[model samples]
Target: MEAAIRASQAQLFEAQAQLTKSQADWERAQNLMQANSLTQPDFDSAKLALATAQGKVKEAEQQVRVNNGKLTESKANVLAARARVDQSQGQVDASVAQENRSQAGVDSARSRTVGARSNVEQANVALGDIFLKAPMDGVILTRSVEVGAQVGPGTVGFAMADTHHVLVTFGVPDILVRDLKLGQRLDIKCEALPGRTFEGTVRTVAPEADADSRVYKVEVRVDNSKDVLKVGMIASLDLVDKEDSPRSIIAVPLGALMPNKDQEDAYQVYVIKDNKAKLRDVTVGRASGDMMEITSGLEEGEQIVVEGGNRVNDGQTVKVKS
Candidate 1:
């Protein structure tokens, strides 16, 4: 379209040049006719040439206008198409961000226990027997060392696991570790026990990511009083932040919100900072009645202008009413 406009403009310039030359020629012909030097046929031909040049100039100007109009329409269509692409990309990004993030792994305990009777029997032959007791009550799963094989410290005597309250451990990416906290609930599901969902509480979260996997380890403790979950069983964990057990959401009264004139489809509010009302841009989320959820740009315990917002201006000193 731009190329067409340029071509039309070039044609218009050429037509204007021709019109100038024709006018000069017609003037010379008129003077010659009055001085009786030029013939009537030649004078009539000059007049006709002048009129034809004028018509060509008008035609070129019209073509240039038409081409310019088409160019503007084409530009508008391009802008509309780009806007649609941007909107689609934004929706895709939001969906990815909103997706429930979780991780899964197979875990089993490995701590050992030594029987007191076996330790006493070996005490007569050896220099005092050392009895190893497990901290928790559970069944011993494996006994690695034989009886009196000259065992020392750090030897795996017997591996035991607490069945009454099993622990499910997994590793998650760095992004998920931030949201996880102690005592947070997670849904644990074992393949062996179908149609059963056990509630688990977060027991531990590794402070740093593992060097090899680049993920943080998280342990969840679940109630297994029914003895349904066994050792070496695989279980999948679902991080729970559902509506029934919703996480705390920061919100403000609807009256505090004000339109952001500089940006489209954006909002702002005046927050009381240091006894001054300061304008702040905030990303809003789902609204509930008189309260509006703020996804970003606001923190808990920060005071805001919930009433008479129109009277407040940004950076204006304000007094709090007791």
Candidate 2:
């Protein structure tokens, strides 16, 4: 900037010097004209020279103004550069701070990870002192762990289902999945409970498919308040047709009775009325293979026409094949 100012000042001085010489020459010419020694043309020429010199001074001054403007713009550019440097410095500081925090988090997580592993080891050591015990006053149905066995956290010591309140499990087919619901009535029978009848309801259904049996696991909660039922005792799980049952009742297919399909919102079934095939809607209660409950929209002995329903349609005549 200083260099630029010096150059502009030098140009102005040169212009001033030219103006001074023109004035001195013009004065001499004026004197000559006044004495009639210089011609009128010569006097006019001197005057015009003075005017041109003045115009040069004005032009130099205008150039100075332009140079000043350039200097101002240069200063502004410097300030902008400084501001950018400051902004960049702030960003670097913030990034460094964030990196430091990340490093701290990593260190903390490492410590926690070590502590978690230690706690796991300690838990295993403590299990050495903890012995498995029977939970209730009942016969043991299974023994998964023996004396001096090395067991882990998830190890099963034994399985002891309550014998005092025994209930049977059965399958409900997909065809009858719709006719059952929770708390629906069930007719249960066991050779052990001969000459006596036991009543139950659809209790629990599995939420997954059983790959081995291809059937659902359905649970029937029985009222063994009498303590007559025993665990592992096989029994018949009888589901009453929902159609024959009253309102608020449900039935499902026996196969769909598997525990897994219980989570299904509903099941499907077919209805045959007045020699016409109609798709009937019903709610699911519990799953039992090959059969289910008719929670609603059905009645007992209604000629359900279970077989060969795939070929029939609504309002279409279908002869009972068997």
Candidate 3:
């Protein structure tokens, strides 16, 4: 299905390129025909080519649409296959439990119980199938079953989400994914909670990039003790490196640093030493919002120019802005 989609997309591009060339040729033929420089047979041929190109473009577009639908159906088939596997596992577990219960019954019914247990074991081994199990530990978001509903293999019994440690899953560009690691703590801000900021750990970093988008999925797990963060809430997150250790670094406004033109990954900051603007090379770490952590070349209690540092020259005398 994916191959078909790719082929259709290629055909669409080829059709579009042909259409462009055909339109240009048809326009040129029109001008030549008006001037009596082109024969009627040649002009008609250009017109026919334009019409054919237009039809090919339309046909390619429809093929692409059809291929997309087939791709969606293919994905659904994969999900159904997984569901069947889960259901089979559940049935096996139920059979095992029944056998265990029957074995613990009275001595008088021991023979009957033995037969029943053997029958169950045989059925379990022969069929090799079971019902669905909840994928994770969480509250049921939706219950699709009633008291006595005849559920089949693919029937969804319940929908659940882990809200205790609410996960905010988002995609990051492949280029930036190299900097991310599991267990790294990040700061998350929810649109629902205006000024409040929440801390979350990077629970999952997808090893592969998405085929279509070329981005990797990253899930951040935030502790929702008070249930402040709910499911489906839109959140903005700041990815931070655990190596930075924000608590131990001297954080300053991001505006304070100026990029060094001659060097890569180097920045310069103006520090007020004895009331004079002194230039210092600093190694910057992870950034969170307006603040940036200084991993080296800056210390706590040092006065650094946060504003109007762009206009100040290195080692130049600058007035203190009240």
Candidate 4:
């Protein structure tokens, strides 16, 4: 395309040169005719020649114009073609950037895959240790692992009862279950311990009732730091208070309250006052038997006698003393 344009430009330049020469010659002929030095016929012939030369000059000029116009169009086409080339270059650059981004993602995925493979190997090694061995000097609660049986990680090889700390399981009726979160402290006691006391907390609760039964599975996390408790043991449970209830209404028997209410939303013990216990509605927040968080109702230093509140009436005047 460029070669063709150059050729046309050359032709335009040649036409321009020829037109200039013809115009100069015609001017000279006109001057001769006017001077009368030439004969009449010769003058007429000169005039005719001049007119013909002028015509030729005009024709040459027109030819130049035509060639120039074609050249201009060719130049425009070349400019447009170059613009398309530049745009294609930009697209190539963008493709390179995308390729680099994808390469980085692939590298990350490969690293994660390697790490996961290592974890699987570690898990397999742990599973290989099914051979029974005493974890520590302790009594076993119950052993369910047999000589050769495929078991999952959650399988209890043998329960140590750890006697050092205990965990109790129970259900929190739906009526009392609500808004109970993990880590809330609880007071616990077992029939085997009788008067002895324990402490625990809301550990976990079932998301749905068991298929066989409609009770919410609840777990109370207890600490037997003194090694006085064991696993799989039955214990009475009571939630001291719901997270939002007031502290004053959470009082309960140190022996009756267990940190393991399987996570009851809350519980309350109304004190007999003014001769009536009033069963005054209360919101328990947190409790530990000695005292509880009263989210609402009850007051600081109010008489909440725990001895015989079950028989009291609302607003009843009774002996108010701690």
Q: Per-candidate TM vs. native?
A: 0.31, 0.31, 0.32, 0.29
In model 1, which range of ten residues has the least summed lDDT? 104-113
Please give the lDDT score at residue 223 for candidate 2: 82
Candidate 2 runs further than 4 Å off: 1-132, 148-155, 205-216, 240-322
Which tens-of-lDDT digit does each residue in 250-288 have in candidate 4?
A: 344432222223335333455555645544444433333
Ten residues in a row with the worst lDDT in model 2? 252-261
A best-first ranking of the candidates according to their TM-score comes to 3, 1, 2, 4
Q: Where is the poorest 10-residue window by lDDT in model 4?
A: 254-263
Writing each residue's lDDT as its tens digit, candidate 2 over 218-246 gives: 77878887777877554565444555544
Best by lDDT: 3
Residue 148 displacement in candidate 1 (angstroms): 8.5
Error in Å for residue 265 of model 4: 21
Candidate rank order under lDDT = 3, 1, 2, 4
Per-candidate local distance difference test: 0.72, 0.62, 0.73, 0.56
| Candidate 3 per-residue C-alpha lDDT over 70-174 given as tens digits, one digit per residue, 9 for 90 to 100 | 566555555555555555555555555675554334343444445555555554543323223456767668879743367777888778887778888766655
**Against the hidden true structure, what lDDT does model 4 obtain?**
0.56
List, in order, the clash count of every candidate structure: 1, 56, 6, 29
